[model samples]
Target: MGLFNRIKEPIFLKESSNAEIQIEKLKALKPLLNPEGQNIIEQDIKHLEYGIVGEKNIAFELKNSHMTMYILHDVYLEDGDISAQIDYLVFTKKICFVIECKNLYGDIEINSAGDFIRTTDFRGRKKKEGIYSPLTQNQRHLELMKKLKVDNKNNILTKFVVGKYFEDNYKSVVVLANPKTILNAKFAKKEVKEKVIRADQLVKYIKNMYEQSKEIGVSDERLLEWAQSFLELQKEMLKDYTDKYEQYKIYKDKAVKSIQKIIPTVEDKKATTIIVKLPVEETEIFKELKAYRLNKSREENIKPYFIYNDKQLKDLISKMPRNNDELQAVAGFGELKINKYGNDILKIMSKY
Candidate 1:
């Protein structure tokens, strides 16, 4: 059994645009509520405060821009037993930014295997610690979006988001909202950089996305309407640390989780649809990936095959592993290579 017990109604925690106002409201209501209710509210506020700060940092940067993007904050949704807690969902006609905010004030580093390490400078003494990867956490949100038909296939993003015809693709991003903190995930490949960024880089990163996606366009008015409908349709669910720990500790996928893990781009799906008789290594994408690997291998002074040979790269192209475990399942991908270069390979494959 799970740690959560169900009553008649689950008092889903409230999400707020203005954290200060909501915090005050909760404080005012504390004395009038039951002990349990009050405890839940307190926990929500305690945890959400940090996240909201980070989100607002991103928002403040976006506010000055004239770009046609809709920004939604604290989107807590529920569907049966599953829930998705999103910090910021910034949407344009062409792309959706599913941003996970990290409000850490420190130097941070994440290896290719997705191990996260942070060093906080406090009183001139640096304290270092390892934490779970937020990249993995944001991936769950993307899956939830896919399941809800908000991403990928169907465009009925929310019941209340009327017209019921808006659609865009998702790109998972982990944002470190403290500019003072230094982040070095440079060990990752070219494509992986877009997924992780510091606060100062957030606006520029978004602008880059806008530049790339300007071809698929939506008007500013329609985008704002969609944003409003999203805000109205948001059904509060568990989004706090205590709540996640108590329930949904694992992101459960009932069916073939392998196919679900694949984050194929529109181009990739199109490429797969075409039947090519060429050997897997001779395929256009496979060769591009091989060339990419050869360049990296030479820089590291290792054999190109050490990264992945023609056959191994072909296997990767065919299987399209989205995560470390799936990549490990492919032939010739041992634990060492999976830890060292699995993410880059996955990122490359997901694109095409």
Candidate 2:
């Protein structure tokens, strides 16, 4: 039944993304902020634009694949406090692919240990840094999907059967959406190399996997039903991407108002000088935190951003977390990270 009743082309159940909405929101809020705040917003807009272009590239490939498939873009799922913002979910008759898209501006290398390293050239110098593995990230999404499916079963036997089926059927893929990116994965493990591929190779990769699978293909109707089951599990994400910018705008406005009231009239002989402190980026604590990150990166032979990015650093400064428990409140600081660098970070924050 599956051989004769296959889908002719890709059918997109949910095609839109929230990234476009975020870009519009940031642009509207940019004019209201000060110079520093405006600069931050500009950087965010550029990042979002790059991501949008990458997703579109993937969409174009799937649209022109001429294969039987169901595609969902920008799916958000939550299991209790944990959440995943998946880039693409491609469903076939025999397998479902959970894809993570990276539109990076540099070359990528995968070592034998499965470590992801990115190298970029500035002027005549080459800078190399380790990046968080997209494969690992996509694997987490797959695990969440498996748990959700297994938990839905009422009996223990049914749960066990469902878990094993999900493990065999679901696949995780990391797609580099940047066409110009140079990938060097020769020394990587066989499994790691197969899971990572360029955007242009996505169609061929899926077809190859489909052909190798021994599982029987379902009809087009069954395929749609399988895809729709996941679509029904999608939840509305409550995260506000523009929240920090809004807070910065409020802080800038208050500073301006305070300066206005303190200014003296022309009749006054001595002019009052009210000095407003610069933004957090220019403070001594910020510099020290950056220095610590660089030193720690060197010590661990990893990228500085892997420990914490610039935005996360600023969050630490603003929140001034004094212990491991408080540090957990910051984004990206999981149990492993807190246990690894939590004490040192707390010590640094104690100085100021």
Candidate 3:
């Protein structure tokens, strides 16, 4: 079968090696637990079972996309100390879609800050609680994937050339797996509604998105190769988490991007290093800068490059600002930009 080859039925958590692995752990714990400990384990098992059911529900609904895309379920990816489990990852060569499934039920309200509020019935007693934000949960997945590169193309490529794909990559979704749930986020941003959708709306959303994504221009073989690489990474992560028997690591503090490789060429018995300014595009920094612009543009419904043009991008990269005062030297980055993105630009530069 091809990497995306479909079986008579979908390959979901029910078919996952990790599922079997997890089940065995449950079995092994059975004989050793006292009643109180068993109760705690049972609750953990219940949550696990519920999560798998959500994943299975979404996987089945995604079948209409099998012929055109690759569907992955129960993906666990570890980034350094952090373990990220994705319920469903659907993608084509040019476009990657992430859906974080929430098996939650009740009336859901999302505030502008992206906090989740759940209010529902418990034998008519009316219960309410706050759940962690799925938007942020899926955002972590998108960020980690964007950070992965065969090589840092940002050091040599144009943003539109290397980054158009990254811009689309962040457009992820959060699916409420239950049809009984009601979304009451009247104050949710327009972008939030665009991303978070109901289960029944998912198929139509993917089909529409796939249609729009048809122009990606990557070949089947290369695209398949790219996808397979991501899958290979996931397989490694599965073993990584399982053996971790120490327990999964929670990321409380954000880790800044570290410089993993440095670029230099030898000349006349000396090493000549090429400096990189990652905040400007049309230059080596173009891809990162361009993706940033695209993200900002989508948020405000403005043109992607409305902040700066090609010449300005080239100039900004060359200026290589290291701080607020230095940023003022880059063309088009006036006081407003210096105030708004100065810190962020410096941080991105620090990583390179």
Off by over 4 Å in 1: 1-15, 18-48, 122-125, 150-168, 219-229, 237-352
lDDT tens per residue, model 3, 1-352: 3533443233332236355456556656544555655566567667767767776777768774443565667676544444567777766555667888888868999888777899989887888899888888898887776655423345655544555557664358999888788988779888886788888888788767767874654665565665566675563222211122212222211111111235455555555554432322233356677677678778888765555555555555544667877676564565655676677777766654
Clashes of each: 0, 0, 2
Query: Please, what is the whole-model Cα lDDT of each candidate in the order they appear?
Result: 0.63, 0.83, 0.62
* Candidate with the greatest lDDT versus the true structure: 2
Which is better, 1 or 3, measured by TM-score?
A: 3
TM-score of 1: 0.51
Clashing residue pairs, candidate 2? none
lDDT of 2 at 111: 100
Model 3 misplaced stretches (Cα beyond 4 Å):
1-20, 150-155, 158-165, 213-217, 235-352
Q: Write the per-residue lDDT of candidate 1 for residues 155-270, one digit (tens) a residue.
A: 44554352243233567888899777788887765556668898778778877876776345655455555456556546532211222222222332211111322344675563
Candidate 1: deviation at residue 334, Å? Answer: 48
TM of each candidate vs. truth: 0.51, 0.70, 0.60
Q: For residues 1-352, what per-residue lDDT tens digits would candidate 2 score against the true structure?
A: 4433547888888898878876886898888888889999999999999999999999999999998899999987656556688999999999998999999989999999999999999998999999999999999999899888888789999999998788668889999999999999999999999999999999999999999998889878888988888887775332346547755674443211122225675787566776655676767788888999999999999888878877667667756788887787565566667889998999988876
